[model samples]
Target: MKKVLVTGASGQLGKCFQKIASEYPEMELRNFNSSELDITDQNRLQQIFSEENPEYCINCAAYTNVEKAEDDEETAFKINAEAVKNLAEVCKNTGTVLIHISTDYVFDGKATNAYRETDVVNPINVYGASKLKGEEYIRQILDQHFIFRTSWLYSEFGHNFFNTILKKAEEGATLNITTSQTGTPTNANDLADFILQLIREENSEFGLYHYSNLGEATWYDFAKAILEFSGKIDQVTLNKSGYYKTRAERPTYSVLDKQKLQETFKKLVLHWRDSLEDLIINRFRKI
Candidate 1:
């Protein structure tokens, strides 16, 4: 079996990997939550690497509080950038292929079309800048790394937009989602599946890639779909507010170009609506 390690196994995307790990029985997975393996603690990381000796290390630990990151810049950089540097250094020494997750926020949201891997990045917020720094560190330190920049990720687990909408609808609450921002709503499960499949195929066409569900929508469009899919459209009041107040500046349009991923893997990218509907009907609703 191919031994693999997952950091930040408690988060939404990490949990998605854990949930589907059993399906890929050829891989032996070692999952570690933040408490178990702090990416910032290089000593602990070294010890874990020595003990596990995993052929692949998927680094999912990150500081994802976009609004709070504005004021807490130090903490965000510590976890997102410095900690990533530590991981990259360790992976380089251990000869472990590192698969790191990044954000589409690296772009300043000024692009008229979808963002390609070669697009010049100009992060407008602290969170985006920190993630970009981490990506840079990985590129400089490790030659065998996969940096996947994804946008508007959501899933059945954790405190994401998808779950928040479901909770509000259950309580019969009114929601004023914004139509100002445009991006793709990526299902975390589909991303996890793609990564595992990449490892399975032993695909070496790695460097940096943009991965997200096909098509794009505004936050309002996403919220409406969530309600519609769950059969709760009429249970709650959903409004189309042109803008929402926020401390951080977000990209107005962050749709990623998936031509590279599609052409490389020769796999189909599911549309956001279809993936959202599948997760709700096949997984979330059952829970």
Candidate 2:
């Protein structure tokens, strides 16, 4: 049986991978979060990898606190950049395929069109720069790898936009969301499914790819949709806020062009609204 090891198994995307892994009976799955395996500790990683000898290493671990990354640049780089380099080098030596998760923040949000896989990156914040550096490290050290760049990720297992809006609605609070910023919100489950498909297909020609649900929306639009979907649209008042500037400069328009993925995989995810509804009805309501 082919063995697959997933890092950051406690995260939203990692949980999604765990759920999808159940379908593959012929594949052995090993999962690890920060507590289980600290990628920054080279010796620890070496020991774990030596014992596991995984055929594929899906690296879902990352420092994703966007605003906090500004103050914690050293920690962020350690996880997002340095740790990635370590994993890529180990994967290269062990002849293991590495799947690295990245973000849309890598783009500067200056483009009028959706960013393609080949688009030049110009990160505007520390978090984005660190993730972009991780991508570069993977490219430099590993020959067989898949770098998936996604945006606005949410899931039932982690803190994200959808859960935040839901919490605010529960508190009977009016939320102020930015309408100027636009991008696609990707469900971690959909991304997990895509990763599973890629492994099954075993496409050797590896490179960067973008994955998100079909369509795009502003933060305001997404919040409104979430409220309406959760049957709390009447209670939530939507207000618009300007960019106003902050420690971490966010992209105004980081919508990724997923046509390359659509073309390559021939798989399309549901619209953000539809997926949000499904998540609420199935997962949030149960919790």
Candidate 3:
């Protein structure tokens, strides 16, 4: 069995990996939450790398708060950049292939067309800048690495747009989501499945790639889709707003192109609406 180590096991995407780990019997996954594995602590990371000696190390640990990152730049950089540097170093020494999750926020969101992996990066926020720094560190430190830059990720677990909308609808709260930004609403579970596919196939054609659901949508579109898919459209009033006030400025448009991912992996990428519908109908049927 191929052994894999995952960091930030408590986060949404990390939890996605945990939820689907059992399906892949040929792979053995060892998960570590923040408390269990302090990625910022280099000595602890080295020790764990030495002990586990995993063939793959998936770094899901990141400072993802966009607004809060504006005020807490140091903390964001520490976790997103410095800690990632440490992980890359340890992975390099241990001969472990690093699978890192990055953000589409790395782009300035000005491109009228979908962003290619070769596009120039110009991050607009602290969170994006820090994540870009982490990506740079990985590229510099290790060659056997896969950096997947995805957009608008949400899952069944954790505080995300999908859960927020569902909870608000359950409480009969009127929602006014923004239409300012345009990007794909990627299901974290879909991303998790794709990562496992790479590991299972032992994919060697790895470097930088953009991965997201096939189609793109704005926050307003995403909210509407979630409500409609969950059969909660009549439960609450959903309005489209041109603006949503926030501390950190987001991209006006940040849709990522998945042409490289499709051609490289030769895997069918599901549309965002289909994925969301499936999650609502099958996965969240109990709710």
Stretch of 10 with least lDDT, candidate 1: 278-287
lDDT by residue (77-173, candidate 1, tens digit) is 9999999999999999999999999999999999989999999999999999999999999999999999999999999999999999999999999
Model 2 agreement with the true structure over 11-52: per-residue lDDT tens digits: 999998888787877777899989999999988888889999
Clashing pairs in 2: none
Residue-by-residue lDDT tens digits, candidate 3, 1-287: 99999999999999999999999999999999999999999999999999999999999999999999999999999999999999999999989999999999999988999999999999999999999999999999999999999999999999999999999999999899999999999999999999999999999997999999988898999999998888899999999999899999899999999999899999989999999999888866675
| Candidate 2 segments whose C-alpha is farther than 4 A from its true place | 284-287
State which candidate, 1 or 2, has the greater TM-score: 1
TM-score of 2: 0.95
